[model samples]
Target: MTLTPQDRTIVEATQAGLPLVTRPFAVVAESLGLSEAELIDRLKQLKAQGVIRRIGAAPNHYRLGMTANGMTVWDVDDAVVDSLGEKVGALPFVTHCYRRPRALPDWPYNLFAMVHGETREEVIAKRVEISSLLGKACRAGDILFSTRILKKTGMRLRGKEG
Candidate 1:
């Protein structure tokens, strides 16, 4: 999508992340010489136009004492996967969940959910809860534990050449 010069400036200014302050938007607006209200309005417009999906905090799960992270994959019946996915996504222990296309013979999982806890055992326990919820609809499943942390970042705008 083509962003206006002003919107481009806003994206460039805040893409790294909003300022770490009580009033982050106000700080960003001040830096860009725009009022806080104007910045918020533009952001809302961008979201409505599908230029941005969402604006929210990306917390460090490890720092929050959730060191054990596992991505649980399930081979759920395609007929009910979407509905079951909604239920899995709503569960308190599931940080994120969604449905994916199966790779057939070798890999059959179609439902994916990320669970976090302080230990592998805890994560496995949470996985059991998910299995219980899936019931007979889920045929096979597995958990892939995270070995290291990776930086999570959003899209960034390139600087204009002078």
Candidate 2:
């Protein structure tokens, strides 16, 4: 991606958080030898170009009292999976919901939902609730708890793709 003068400053400064002060942008601008407006403008440009997907925090759910986090997969009917996937994704307890192509030979689950709770029982209860919501459509399924989290972070600006 082309890095215009302003693009370079916003990319570098925001690679770090929006500085942690009252005049954060001013501080970032100073460091880059540019004005606050210029820095802000660059961020706007980057967003418009779709070079920056989002500016937000990536919190570790497990560390934040969400001890029981599981990747629950379902063997759903192909005809209804697309619709059910959207419905399940709308639930509050389900943080991440997506469709993965069914695996061959050893695997068949195609729908995946991430469920999190404070304890194992709570997680199981939520799963049952989710299962009930699916109303027997989730013929077979499994949950794989998160044992450890390797890393969590926002976008990477030093590289082209993150």
Candidate 3:
């Protein structure tokens, strides 16, 4: 999709992530020299045109005392993966869930879900819950606990101000 220069400014300003305060869009809009309504309207247009998927926040779970983070991968039945993924994704502990293509001869996982908890045991319990939810649909599953912190950055768009 083609984005106007103003849309590029919007994307660039938001790429750094919104401020942690009430009326974040208002602050951003003012910085971009645009009204809040104009910014909202342009964002709606951008979304309608599929330029952006959705706007949301990525909280730092570590700061929230969620130290144990596990990415669980499953070899689920192809026919039931979507339904199972939706169910797993809806769970409160799961931060992210999606289906992925499996690599042959080595990797066989088709579904992935990330769960965060205050402790390792809690993460494991969440894994059990997911296994129970999948039942026999899950051929196999494994949990990979995060051992190190990686920088988390969202999408970035190139623009004049960027």
Using Cα atoms with residue i matched to residue i, what is each candidate's TM-score against the true structure? 0.86, 0.75, 0.88
lDDT of 1 by residue, 15-52 (tens): 78887889999999999999999999999999899988
The sequence of per-residue lDDT tens digits that candidate 2 reaches over residues 91-122 is 99998899999877678899999999999888
Model 3, position 159: C-alpha lDDT score: 52
Clashing pairs in 1: none
Model 1 residue runs over 4 Å out of place are 155-162
Return the clash pairs for model 2, or none.
Answer: none
Stretches off by above 4 angstroms in model 3 are: 20-23, 48-50, 160-162
Report each candidate's C-alpha RMSD, comma-separated, in the order given.
Answer: 2.2, 3.5, 2.3
Ordered list by lDDT, greatest first: 1, 3, 2
Question: Among all windows of ten consecutive residues in candidate 1, which has the lowest summed lDDT?
Answer: 148-157
User: Which candidate, 1 or 3, would have the higher lDDT against the true structure?
Assistant: 1
Where model 2 places Cα greater than 4 Å from the true spot, the runs are 1-16, 32-34, 42-51, 154-162
Computed on alpha carbons, the lDDT of every model, listed in order, comes to 0.92, 0.82, 0.91
Which has the higher TM-score value, candidate number 1 or candidate number 3? 3
